[model samples]
Target: MAGSKTATLYRMVMPDHLCPSGLKAKWLLEREGYTVEDHPLRTREETEAFKAKHEVSYTPQAWIGDKRIGGYTELRKHFGRKQLEKGETTYRPVIALFTMTLLMALAAAWVATGEPLTILSAEWFVSFSMCVLAFLKVRDVESFSTMFLNYDLLARRWVPYGYIYPFAEGLAGVLMTAKILPWISVPVALFIGTVGAVSVIKAVYIDKRAIKCACVGGDSNVPLGFVSLTENLFMIGMGLWMGFNAFA
Candidate 1:
């Protein structure tokens, strides 16, 4: 099918700049089993002339048997891919964070106890996840605070709480992970987690005001909903379990 089917691709490859979209388009065409006729406009004048002739503003155009296909995005659509939209909420960031943390936790358990599936692994997973999430928020506190103000009840009331939240989470995570200073860690985690859970519930479930989640970070496209609620619940549960071990 590759050699039999053919595609004509026009892309830009200037002395100073190369078009990434052109490379992506070529890769997609080849992946879809099409033999490609690549035409690269190596100079500014050539690129402009090519564009003027085609009556198109963008490069990396494709043609299949005399039928003109647009740029990389259009090519993706031609192959039946869901077109990506700006500001689309996705769980990919949280999913990736959790997946990486789980693996790290398992590795830690294996190193500590000579087994991967120990009780300590679960604890490590949650703590590691919390630490990473906190780091993301703290990386850009100003941005996170602005987004957090959108739905967090406490942050809305006291703006400083938004800035403080990340450090508090990181502190609790560090103390919990090290299994030291449980008295401080447990209370901190419990208070923040409880507040977060209530705020998420009120905003998403009760009020139904759709917004972005500041859980992963300020710049993420993760939605303010179930995933955020689950993160808060995890922190709450971790706090309770640790408290029982320390106090009860």
Candidate 2:
């Protein structure tokens, strides 16, 4: 026991607030065959004092053989774990949104027409996806526009376009869902979809910039790529389909 590996961990363990990362660090140390000297700063005052004393920005600190290991992220890095790297993003959010939208479309169609699966389910899926994406943008319009403007040609040219884009998307989506005037929704969807598609292709493929996508909202980790292009293409297809159906 005396000759075993040893580490010291300082983490929060207050009645009101316990540090999850600290517990994780402790577990990681134990898992790695290290005996940890656990220290709990139980109160806000104690935590502040500890931070000041250590001159560190964050807590859940660890020390092994006189070498200080930082917080959770640092711990992962120490173990050679690949954390979220620069320009590294995920499409999980977009995939989740699309999955949920598809389910919703199917559910709604089944409830209305008593057919669980139908051709019209595709329409519902597109419309619902538009609504969901617009809602997410609405959550942080400024952030969304900042990301949008990164690649959107129109938004870059006309600053107000960024502001109007989300509203346009939401309005078109709602109108489509209500089976309202295709006169409005069709054109709106087509124009925006075309512009967005072009912008995405130009930025991602042409310029070869690995940037975050604003499709599912501003705060997304989804990278600008084929998924983004697909979304725009689907919107175009939906708009065209609806428009043709209106006259035919």
Candidate 3:
């Protein structure tokens, strides 16, 4: 018997819990009218074999019509060329963790110096507040799945970005708290804040329409507008704090 109309297969091997870009690609592909066969490769051997066969080493290795598109950016470009687009959303986990770490660092610094009115204290308060907001905005895994399903968005594409953002933030916090990389903390914090601000602004620009936020996991249902605004404000405040300290 001939294969059914949905016989087309698009393969994707995403690292576990780290595949925002890959997810976005998958979402876009399905939206563009394609069947996607997604598998999360957990082991290094699995990743290597897949890469050797496909001539690519990446979380989101896409095979469409005998052509392999490596990585989220490539998939994005491919989807764009086809004139099929989904709303761009920032990865939440990473942003949240990053914000959390920054806040923790500030709090620690304040404790160490015993100065509640110092720049470090201000930074701590700001970071703490943003972290709280980030946590509040987190979307549950189920909601994330739903958002992608509704929009044909991929899980791999945006998930990794979300993971990375927080990983950086957390790492910076550890460094700051441990005094292992004290010299770099302020600069790194400033950079993170700037990048975050820019990212939020870009999201607002890309999707002018009000949409459901996949910020936290699926559990939290917040409007995108408020989340975006809050994110921007937090980042801006962090940036300003960092700049003020640097110049002072």
Using TM-score, give the best candidate's number: 1
Each prediction's Cα RMSD?
1.6, 4.0, 16.5
**How do the residues 1-248 of candidate 2 rate in per-residue lDDT, one tens digit apiece?**
53299989999999998999999998888887889899998999999999999999789999988999888778888988777866568877887999999999999999989996887787899999999989999999999999999999999999889989989999889988888899999999999999999999999899999888899888888989898899889889988988998867
How do the predictions measure up, each by TM-score? 0.93, 0.78, 0.37
List the candidates ranked by TM-score, beginning with the highest. Answer: 1, 2, 3
- The TM-score obtained by model 3 is 0.37
Segments in model 1 whose C-alpha atoms lie over 4 Å from true places: none
**Cα lDDT tens digits for candidate 3, 80-160:** 663323544444554665566566656676678865456665556555544444443332434445542322122334554
TM-score of predicted model 2? 0.78
Q: Any runs in candidate 2 off by more than 4 Å, and if so which?
A: 1-9, 23-39, 48-57, 62-70, 75-82
User: Could you tell me how far off, in angstroms, the CA of residue 171 lies in candidate 1 after the best superposition?
Assistant: 2.1
**C-alpha positional error of residue 138 in candidate 1 after TM-score superposition, expressed in Å:** 2.4
Instruction: Compose the digit string of candidate 1's lDDT tens values, residues 1-248.
Output: 67889999999988888999999999999999999999998998998999899999989899988999999999999999787578999999999999999999999999999999988999999999999999999999999999999999999999999999999999999999999999999999999999999999999999999999999999999999999999999999999999999899
Minimal lDDT window, size 10, model 2: 79-88
In angstroms, how far off is 155's CA in candidate 1? 0.3
Candidate 3 steric clashes: 32
**What would the C-alpha RMSD of candidate 1 be, to one decimal place?**
1.6
